[model samples]
Target: MQSEDNLLKVLIAEPSAIIRNGLSVTLKRIPGSWIQPVEISSIENLEHVLETNKPDVLIINPNFWGYVDMTTVRAWSAASKLKIIALVSSLSSDVILKKYDESISIYDSPEDIKEKIFRLFDTSDTEKDKSSEESETLSSREKEIVVLVVKGLTNKEIAQKLFLSTHTIITHRRNIARKLEIHSTAGLTVYAIVNKLVGLDEIKDNFTL
Candidate 1:
């Protein structure tokens, strides 16, 4: 059994009570009591709840971004290593979807939801070991690409700087994403900062979703 301090705090922000409660119930049935979910039905209270709860993971609807931008939401939980997962119910543009660390469809099965959430945490010993191994396999070029990416450089910009073709830069980025298992620019930024590949000050003002 996991200790209390090791529990994963999850905040579910959805307007519908049924969806919020359903997600909470699904999370609870994951065998271990390591996940502790807190649900809120209003987007207006999101910032306050985020500040107070400091949850490890946030499962929120993308529509809330219309009221609160991704950068602002990230700022409120800057103290914690927060992972924002979009609780998508309707069609969202690719640009909007890429801002989040992950996405879960409303129609996803309970089992699928559990898997997606668990993979983010990677709590199992075997999974942790595999992740560690994969993390170590990043090439120096890939590391450079990751740094440029976190610095808000477009693929074309990075290609120009590195004297490489745009196609090559895109390929490198794809490989980097696969290696790190992080799909979004926001996620890549966090990884770069955490891994000391880029300093926070370098990207604080310039970083985008």
Candidate 2:
């Protein structure tokens, strides 16, 4: 177990409950228990949270910057180590994204979010080792499943295409989730594109599915 002093405090400032809750759920699934995430729906409450919570990381919407002065926030918390990450829900310009230490899209997978958070803090050896090990375990069949999944095929459809039982397909999906630490299809889609298993043009319309 990690000590309290070593805990990674994460403050999520998002207006949408759905997005805020989604990010909170994904962050909790990361390899370690040291992450303590707090959510707030309003940017107005951000300064108070920063003063009281003193979070190590802040995941916020880029639009919030228009309302709050980031420079003032940084000055107020200058004594502590604070990293700001943009929680992007829509297309943001390079100039806007450059203001953040890192940016995560709503479509990004749990694994991708984990990597970004880990990168920010220079995570421990145990977390890094586990991620490295999981990355190497996906079989060729799993890759095929991921491609079909990104292409917007249902489990039953994939089963029919692969000449396998739906039960077997479900089992394979469970194993894939365990191996990749990615439970959402959006994450799988991102993984497929990143690994070149599928082309963006092939799944552009169904990427959110």
Candidate 3:
């Protein structure tokens, strides 16, 4: 467990003062969490802060930045590998809140945001340990296979995507299972979800009977 004195360095990038203040206050109330809301007029400034701070996570609203320049957000997500949790208005239709090709985790209320922060920060240490062990056990090819499996891709689909024979994909799948001690796709999906190798929406969007 993280000590109360050791807080996560969080960067908040939102245009709305009310929402940003609310989130900052809520995070401060958490025992071992430090959230700094960046006071900026635009997304460009948010990227500057990220470049400087390299925070553990970023919380921002996509609408605040215009659609075309959203590439800046995607660049930050890829370059910094930041765990981005975006806020979206529930009133908006067709708002999927895709966080740079990854699924955006939604928070409908302050309570929901609080729950997510606790969940993300509380499990960080344990997950890091498990991730190290898991990484060591799988070969490069096996890791790729595991990622695809967690993405809920069938052997045939994975084969097509990877431009390999279905038989080869099947073999890789079996070897991955044996190496990871995961016996079924269901198990792999659960592992992926827990590990954030793939999001729930990505799995559901790709997986088909």
Candidate 4:
């Protein structure tokens, strides 16, 4: 159960007014939960709201019909001190999977919204156990990649940060998938969070994700 004092403040950054409104209503219905949903049509508006509100979590639509860059998301993550939950229509492609990093959580279906929300806000041993399993399965390179990925880096960004080619980064990502037996970025994001390879506080400095 959520504590009375610690309300789960949330920001919904979606371009579609209908989706935003529907999600907001659902979030508000979660018993003992407090949510603040903001509809943002542009990346600039999203940034502005985050700066002003300092939300605890951000639920974003990656296909918000705008030119969103890695820096934009990273900056939002860094400034708002909020965990990002990315909403996508599907979790099947490599390009979207590549966007999976520690700082962000990915949800494929609208049905998954509440589950993901509760997981983020709830502090439980069940979540801890799940995280432990994920940590135990990671290789050294994949672990390194997780840290960088959480920092909102693209494949090229991660490769450049690690002083390797983009191709090498892709190879590492492939190996990560093979070792974990997971194919989607959403899976990787969950793994990262559960294991603490990517953390909420780690983004305080200019360190890797």
Clashing pairs in 3: none
Measured against the true structure, the TM-scores of the candidates, in listed sequence, are 0.55, 0.57, 0.45, 0.49
Give the Å error, residue 169, model 4.
32
Better of 1 and 4 by lDDT: 1
- Model 1 segments more than 4 A misplaced: 65-67, 123-209
TM-score of 4: 0.49
Writing each residue's lDDT as its tens digit, candidate 3 over 141-188 gives: 556777887776778998898788777666556545644678977887
CA shift at 44, candidate 4, in angstroms? 2.1
Give lDDT tens digits, candidate 4, residues 39-148.
Answer: 66677777777777677777676666653554566576544345666654323344653453222223112333554565554544557667434433544566888777
What is candidate 1's local distance difference test score?
0.76
Q: RMSD for all candidates, in order, please.
A: 13.8, 10.6, 14.0, 14.8
Please report how far candidate 4 places residue 168 from its true position, in Å. Answer: 35
lDDT of 2 by residue, 85-190 (tens): 8887764565666666667767555766776776766645568676445433565667888899889899999999998877767766765775577999999989
Cα deviation of 143 in candidate 3 (Å)? Answer: 35
* TM-score winner between candidates 2 and 3: 2
Model 1: per-residue Cα lDDT over 173-209, one tens digit each: 6556655678999998898888899998999977754
User: Weakest 10 consecutive residues, lDDT, candidate 3?
Assistant: 99-108
Candidate order (TM-score):
2, 1, 4, 3
How many backbone collisions does model 3 have? 0
